[model samples]
Target chain A: MRFGVVRFPGSNCEQDIVIACRYLGIDVDYVWHGDTDITGFDAIVLPGGFSYGDYIRTGAVARFSPVMGEVVRFAERGGPVLGVCNGFQILTEAHMLPGAMLRNRGLKFICETVPLRLERTVCQWVDLPEGTVVRIPINHNEGNFTADAETLARLDANGQVVLSYCEPDGTRAPGGSAPNGSANDIAGICNERGNVFGLMPHPERVVDPEASGTDGQPFLTTIVARLAGV
Target chain B: MARYEIFVTYKQGIFDPPGATAERALANLGYDEIESVKIGKYIRVEVADGPNERARVAEMCDKLLANPVIEEYRIVDAEGAVSAR
Candidate 1:
């Protein structure tokens, strides 16, 4: 299966995504932000890093990149789209996903491995069952997810909340559960149609033990399997 | 050409971390009775004068300058006449 990773002028993690895909034996190509075509790729990944120097706002400028128009069209045609970290921010800005990111609750940049729980949903990217916990690292200064009360309720009922922050033992405390103060401890979400998935953690950075650990392998392999029709 | 100032602030009930930090710092400096402080963005824009100029800028704010989900914006022209959303 071929995966196309979009590289904005300032994207720093596109190479890591290329590495992760290569490790899995998946053919991957770099899709420049200025390019408008995405004809052959089976999946599109918007990797992390400060795009457009995060000017105006994180992902705000990058959302208007020429490639985004093609990406949106691909998504409308049921192609799977994954946005990680700053890529997640761009998804929100482009209105492909719900909610905007506010500054982290602690008002500081955070970089650490946090336990993430998968909630079974319609997302094809995550094949893990509900309530599965994995260790993935999140690094961001503005990752707090904010949405209206009714929208949060709608997302939960529809099973669009794909992943969430949780305690190491797969449990959650009553208060302050999310490290970044995301509403309902939400770490990631998918669109209602279940084709677009966006998350704040860096799965590409943890695809193998050499990169730290292998907890992030399953998330990648499942989608690779889906695209390969395996 | 016309110049305008736009103020963007988080909507009510949304947490403002930077504003809260500043509020706490003020109290530590001996002002205990401070009610609250809000932090927001102040933007200046220059647009060529035309009909419906204020409305056009408001559209820009809705589309890009401000996130309507979390923040509200107000525009003030050179004459200080205010238009808010």
Candidate 2:
């Protein structure tokens, strides 16, 4: 399957997504933030980085970019869209995902590899089973997730929360799981339709065994597997 | 011309980390009377005066200047009167 990676002015992770896609034998193209058409790509990946220099707020400015108008249409059409890190922030700002981001409770920019547990849900990106703990890296200042209590409950009840921070041994603990103090330890979530997924961890950073480990392979390959029914 | 000033602040119950940090710092500096400190953004916009200008500025806040989910915005007209919330 082909993938499209959006390149906003300040995006720094577009190349990483490209390399990851290429390593997996997936044909990909760079979709500029200003470009409005994404007719050929099977899926879209909003990579990480400080888009629009993260001015006003993270993902706030990039949300109105010309290409996002098309991204919204693509997602509304049931196209699978994956937003990683800053891309996730953009998705939230664009209202494709519910809730918003806040500064880390500690008010620090965190850069570390954290343990995340994948929940059994309708998310189309990762095909892994419930409670699978994977090591992924997160680097950001505003990764704390915030949503109203009602929204959180709805997400929980609907299985829209596809991933959450967990201990290394795959257990939940108070205030220990979330590195950023995200509400309910949420690390990733999906919309009601489950076609769009947004997560804070950078799977592309771990795809190369030499660089780290192949623990992230499923996240990128599962789309093909699910669609092709392999 | 109609000039509007917007005050964007996080909604109540949303933790303000920077605000809390500063509050503590100020208290440590002997300002014991200060109860809290909240941080927010202040933006100013100028548009041609018209009947729909008020609605347009509010629309800008709803769409861009503020995220209504986590924050609220207040618009003040050039006369410094609170125009809309």
Candidate 3:
């Protein structure tokens, strides 16, 4: 399968995502933020980075990129779209999801490998059993997800929440688990249709066992299996 | 000319660590009298019309300036200066 990794002006993780895609045996290419056409790819991944220098807000300015229009069209056509970190911020800004990430309450740039519990794994890129715990790296200061009560309820009822930080033993990891103060401890979410996924964790940075942390391999492998029908 | 004020703040469910920390600091500073401290953003705009313009400005807050999910904005229109809600 062909996978396209979007490279915004300040995207720092595109190469990492590209490497992960290639390791999965998928044809990978770079899709510039200025390029509006999202053709020639079965899936697209918006890697993490400080796009637009995070001027107004993290991912706020990047949401207005020329390629975002096509990315929206791509999602509507049922193409897979995954946004990480600032990419998640952009998706929220674009209204592809119903929320926003604000500055971290601690007012510090946090970076570390965080444990994430698999909330719902039936989506296209993931197939693990529900409630599984996986470690993924998260590095961002504005990863707090906030939404209205009704909207949070809707997301909960629809099972749109996909992943959350959890303890290794499977119990809900509180406080420390949430590097940022997101509502409901939400680390990741998928669109109502389940085609578009957004998360604050950097799975690409942990694709291989020796690369950084092997904990993130299953996520990429899940998508690989979906592509290979394995 | 008429004036309008816009207020923005975190939604209910979000954890306001800074606010909590500020409250803690205040308590440590012998200001235990305060209950909570919530950070907020305010914007003021000048327009010609009254209520109609206020509504338009509110819509702008929803569509562009403020994120409705984590933010609630109140607009007040006045003859010269408006106050934020």
Candidate 4:
């Protein structure tokens, strides 16, 4: 499957996503922020970075980019869209996902590998069994996720909470699992329709075993496998 | 043209890490009497004067200037009149 990785001004992780896709043998190309056509791609990825210099707020300015119009349109038609880190922020800003990211609870930019437990939901981005733990790197200053209590409840009830920070042995850590103090230890979520997914962790950075671990390989390969009906 | 200043801050329930950290730092430096500290953003905009300019600014706040989901913003007129939502 062909993946389109968007590159907004100040976006730094687009190349990393491209490299990961290349390693996965998936056809990929860069979609400039100014361009609007994304019809040729099977799925789209909004990679991590300080888009538009994170002006006003993270992802606020980037959401208005010309390319996002098409991305929104594509997502409406039930097309798969994955947003990583800042991309996740952009998705939330674009209203494709719920909630907003706050600054890390420690008032510091955190960069480290953390364990994530996948929720058992039939989403296009993940097909892992329930409660599978995978180690992924999270790097950001504003990764603390917050939402109203009502919205949080709705997400929980609908199975929209797709991933949560967890212990290495796959146990949930109360109060301390989330390095950034995300609400409910949520590391990732999906739209109610499940076509759109957003997460704070960097799955692409861990796709190569030589440089990093291969725990992230399944994230990309799952899409390819589903598309190819393998 | 009218100049306006906007102050955007996290809502009451949302966590303000920088603000909390600053509060701690101040206490560490022997200012233990401080109750709280909050961090926020200040923005200035110059807009053409019109009958509906105030309404327009409010719209701007809702649409882009501030995220209503987690932040509250106040608009200050040049004369220091504050309007909050």
lDDT of 2 by residue, A94-185 (tens): 99999999999889999999999998788888778899999999999999999999999999988899889999999999656898989999
Identify the CAPRI category of the predicted complex in candidate 1.
medium
In model 1, the Cα lDDT at residue B38 comes to: 99
- Colliding pairs, model 3: none
* Cα-based TM-score, every candidate: 0.97, 0.97, 0.85, 0.96
TM-score, A chain, model 1: 0.97
After aligning candidate 1 to the native by TM-score, how far in Å is the CA of A140 from where it should be? 0.5
> Is candidate 1 or 4 superior in lDDT?
4
What are the per-residue Cα lDDT tens digits for candidate 3 across A1-230? Answer: 78888888899999988888777666899998999887888888888999989864677777779999999999998888889888888899888877888787677888988788888643576777888888888899898787878888888888888898777776775454576777888898988888788999998888777667666666666765676677
The C-alpha interface RMSD of every prediction is 0.8, 0.7, 2.3, 0.7
Query: Which digits, one per residue and each the tens of the lDDT, describe model 4 over residues A2-80?
Result: 9999999999999999999999899999999999888899999999999999988999999999999999999999889
Per-residue C-alpha lDDT of model 1 across residues B25-53, encoded as one tens digit per residue = 99999999988999999999999989998
Model 3: per-residue Cα lDDT at residue A214: 68
Candidate 1: which stretches are off by over 4 Å? none
Candidate 3 segments whose C-alpha is farther than 4 A from its true place: A173-176, A227-230, B1-7, B11-14, B42-60, B74-85
Interface RMSD of 2: 0.7
Overall local distance difference test of candidate 1 = 0.90
Evaluate every candidate with DockQ and list the scores. 0.73, 0.82, 0.41, 0.85
Candidate 1's displacement at residue A74, Å, is 0.5
Give the higher-DockQ candidate: 2 or 3: 2
> 1 or 2: which has the higher DockQ?
2
> Which stretches in model 2 have alpha-carbon errors above 4 Å?
none
